[model samples]
Target: MTASYGSAEYQGYLRNDAVTIAEVLRLDGYRTLMSGKWHVGGSYKPRESDLWTPGDLAHPTPRQRGFDKFFGTLDGSGSFFFPHYIGEDDCQIAVETDDFYMTDAITDKAVDMIEESVADEKPFFLYLAYTAPHWPLHAKEEDIAKYQGMYRNGWDTLRTSRHEEMLGKNILEGNWEISPRDPTVHSWADEKNRDWEDSRMATYAAMVDCMDQGIGRVMAKLKQLGVDKDTLILFLSDNGGCAEFLAEEGWVESYPDISPEGKKIVQGNIPNLAPGSGKTFQSYEAPWSNVSNAPFRMHKSWVHEGGISTPLIAHWPNGIAQSAIVHTARHVSDIMPTILDVSGASYPKDFDGVGIQNLDGESMFGVFLNGHGEREQPIFWEHEGNCAMREGNWKLVREFGRDWELYNMAFDRTELHNLRDKDQNRAERMIKEYDAWAKKTGVVDWAVICAHPAMDWVKPAKPEI
Candidate 1:
């Protein structure tokens, strides 16, 4: 809901994007289940370690977020061996294992939830938001082993390979050109040695491979439960694969680094020393992050297509004739109405005695079923002041407090060309509309929005009784 691999434990500072969706679905009479990171809003203080201790889930959890059940951590990063989380009913599992990785555990629990939901013969709205490929670069030995030397080619090579594969798969068309590497990243040749680069990518690839396997497992469960064909599953990342500064937070390693011959080589997640764990902090760094986005201009936290444009794969045998038809018309907020359409549920004017905020998205059910769109609503995003608004083929995007640039999305999906001067009229109109919407939404200034300071402004005023 929020993003894959995001800390499920919502902190006090964040917003409950998931809760908003789940609550609306509940009004539709569907049982909701969420597994994975739910970084909505709550206490994520590291000192309060029980924040993730699974056995003692307190109030303001997924249940409060609209999920009937949840299994996830409060913090975004932690060790796999001593993974911490609170189960359903805020019951602290406090489960720790040398073998259990959080990604696998989250998926397994999701699968189990599906089984129970199916057995009960109730339609379930399941959100399996994963934390794969997130920071800390932790992975199981076997998963890590599978990726040994796989990233030796480094980000430069892997980025090229993924780009080519996506092309063959028609994930990309010939229309878009791959962007150059980010200037901030030191070129591979510029790096002092290859180990830091290779290990960083190796860990990341492991994260991706491990996530793919878990996804396959979840798909298997849906197929097993006889809902694979009917259930609508939309797979997407919250944002682009994160290239956040890893040095500051440190790597949360699950396994010690080993040589290709299976001998311990480098300590994992440690910063400045080797790219490794526990005491050491690390990230895949900037250059490779540029590669991760590929074809797109920037990594996460930026408003460019690379940072915001993600692959949206929708699968529903009963609803879609296109098995893997890629749709560029939808946005993250579109999910709310899409689910309602498929399930024939109605959004509540109010939930739990509280008036509801009007939804920012409309159902995309028609596009899936008719092979065309029924509606095209303006979509807006303002994460950390990297703001963007899309209305049909025209979009207004900008870095907060920076100049706003316009683009023709249909022709410029890669955003290589700017239409600021060429389409001043269109830009002005969209900017006007954006301003109006911002006012309507109680939009904060760029500085506050970017920092994500407490935005208690009412999206919808309280409804009269």
Candidate 2:
């Protein structure tokens, strides 16, 4: 499941035995609904009959997992204009109009569900997972026009400006330095095809801007329903900005070859063809991605701060009495426990004769209420063999097959200096701790996994960590 792409077998989908937060809430008399991306399920293609069927245990749909109603694409990334694998509950659906946009449709469905839940007079839990700013770089013409020349200054200036803004807002510690620009990237002044580069980033910004508009609509709906003050809305990204290019062979195969209106799809990062159109499929590659993850080294798929760090914005006018910035480190695993704590719902040890795995995360509800909380254990991460561990202010991290590097996060959260040689004992202890945690969590070696016959699709070339 940790692999980049899902398989056809049971390994591709979320396990049926596992319990979801939605299931816990539904059991406690809350209506659960979800919209947008649901990539944890099986590999689904609208034309394929041989793939996982409805109600199949090996690749269960969102409705089967715990949601009372579900509407979203099963696959990870696709065209915003015409998604490849959209579904309603357990049934596959098609884009009925040429003007259809994925983000707007998702927001509309979420609003409808909220209104229906209010009509029924039942408390509802809605999981609005937007897939904007992911890939294909598709956006509406109006949205694209808003940011057409905004990024002409290039990533260099953008990164520096953004870093300074973060410092001004106190989002980052004062002592933590801004990381150096990625060595792979060249100076903006020396780059050719400046207009094309600007368009790529502009399209990306447009996608994000459109997503923000959708969120605003959702907030308006909540206010209309008179539940805006009581509802707890949590917003967070799954990862940092992505640097992956879409020029690989077979990349276009995953998307539609033609538009719904019978236009040929222009796929890949085609410099000549400007992005943000329904027919064009492109990504805002590494240069702009570097700016997106500004002041932080690396991008998504790595365990570095740039890859893993994301702001968790908790908005609850009724629950969170006062506004205050909390710098406590937390993981996605803590979300379930935090919801349980806030809602007064008990996590069942045994659900319908199946024993559930014990939760690894502690509740962050205390942090929400008191603006501070202490973690009982150190946080650990291992993705594609890029490993890291954080114990209070100290952090140990390394790329795949590289020696461990140590940093004191309190002073150097940007990881500018490696203190591995200065503090060998602490480094050794944390390495051992990470190893123990990985072993207990059943984390397989990334290299070993890549060598397996089933993973032949994975390119031999290692991605930059």
Candidate 3:
């Protein structure tokens, strides 16, 4: 249901071991179902032959995690056309047809489950996680074609354009200036491989477009089942845009050759080998990713506002009011409490004789009714020592191994100004607060954790080619 980093090479396996919200809802008599990416468990090197043959169907799968039904892949990214680890419930599905695209297929399975739930006349909780717009950006050609020449102006213009649009639409809350283009990226006009670079962005957009189309189909089905008004639909991204410039040659050798149909699979960011095909594995890289997180700094993995920010869309006609953008900071942890509050489900003191951990989330269910609310506690983040804490409008943030920067987000949520030097008092208070939170949460030293034996995946920088 959630797209978690399952690889022990980064975060440890404990991420997948916790009780899921789906399991809790199931205990409340809701029929739990899930489709699409389940990257929280299992690990396997991708291979075309594994499509029909089935790869590592490891323990602690969706079924074990409490979903009654699940169908999807187990890895972070795979061929949308011919995925390597496709599964239906506990069984691995054979990829016999090249016509399959993950966005459509994942939706197809969800619709099937919805129909079954309707036939049984049971209220259901379905978790549909789409790994769209992720790396190894493989999208359908038709979808890709829709975006042809769409990014001709390149990331420079796109970033500024999107920032202006967000400001015009009031999607932004304050006078947050768009952060300058990442210095690492060159000007659009200076880029030599314009066509290839543009094509990569086009493909990435196609993936998002395809996912939107699938979501529309799912919504239509919900309406048809007379559940649209009552069913709560919340959409959110797992993280900000990914800026990890994964050179294909750096990792492609780990995958299996000879695709499912016995064709030699072409992989890498080869300039001539245009992406969007099943045989090719490619990433749009950081230029477009910088645009994706426009007006904000950094990308996924950092504690910058861009890395952790995503808009949450809540739709429930029966229980909530019309569309309204809420600016209150919310964390992913708030989701479970929100669902439980709306469903009138209680957080159990103990489950199956083991004591349950008390919830650390405040429900945003009130926001649905009133369009906005506030949390008493400050939101905190710590990923790989890239840490942040936001209390009201004041924000304290720092990249891994960098000095902390404080910002008064009331007038600058884009984090353009550093108030740490001017207001040392506020910075010290926030840092002290963050230290307490870190200690209470058992956050260990990053250096020690990174040095662990499990982190063997941290390879040295070398020319992959």
C-alpha TM-score for every candidate: 0.83, 0.95, 0.92
- Local distance difference test scores for all models: 0.66, 0.82, 0.80
Residue lDDT tens for model 1, 1-465: 122122232233334333366777777677789988766544343334543332223325666667888887655555443443445546667555435677888888999999998999988998888877776666666666676666666666667787788778887745666676665665555666577667677777777888899999999988887889878888988777666653221232222333223444343334435443323334565666787788788878787887887777788887796754544556777888788778777777666666656677777777786776734678877665677888878789998678899988777777778899998998899888888977776555645432333332211122121
Give the poorly placed runs of model 2, Cα more than 4 Å off. Answer: 1-10, 44-54, 248-252, 458-465
Distance from true location, Cα of 212 in model 1, Å: 1.8
lDDT per residue as tens, model 3, 1-465: 121233333443223324578878889898999998877664445653344322223435787777899988766777777666778888887877658888888899999999999889988999999878887778988889999888989899999999999989999987578998877778898888888888899999999999999999999999999889999999999999986654555555556545767887676677757888877877776688899988998888887878988999888999887688889898998998999999988777766566766787799998998888998889888888789999988899998888999998878877888999999999999999999998887676667666666444433223322
Task: State in Å the error of residue 190, model 3.
Answer: 1.1
The better candidate by lDDT, 1 or 2, is 2
TM-score of 1: 0.83
What is the alpha-carbon lDDT for the whole of candidate 3?
0.80
Report the error of model 1 at residue 109, Å.
Answer: 1.2
83, model 1: CA deviation in Å? Answer: 3.2
* RMSD of every prediction: 7.8, 2.5, 3.3
Q: Can you write out model 2's per-residue Cα lDDT over 1-465, one digit (the tens) per residue?
A: 423343222266776467998899999999999999987875455335336365666567789888999998777778898776678988988778878899988998998999999989999999999999898899999988988888888888999999999999998865477888887788799878788888888888899998999999999988998999989888999998888777635434545667667888877776768999888888887788889887888889888888998999999998986788888788898899989988888999977689978876889888878878877788999887899998988989999998899999888888889999999999999999999998887777778766766456434223344
Candidate 3 off by > 4 Å: 1-11, 14-17, 47-58, 458-465
Of candidates 3 and 2, the better by TM-score: 2
**Ranking 1 against 3 by lDDT, winner:** 3
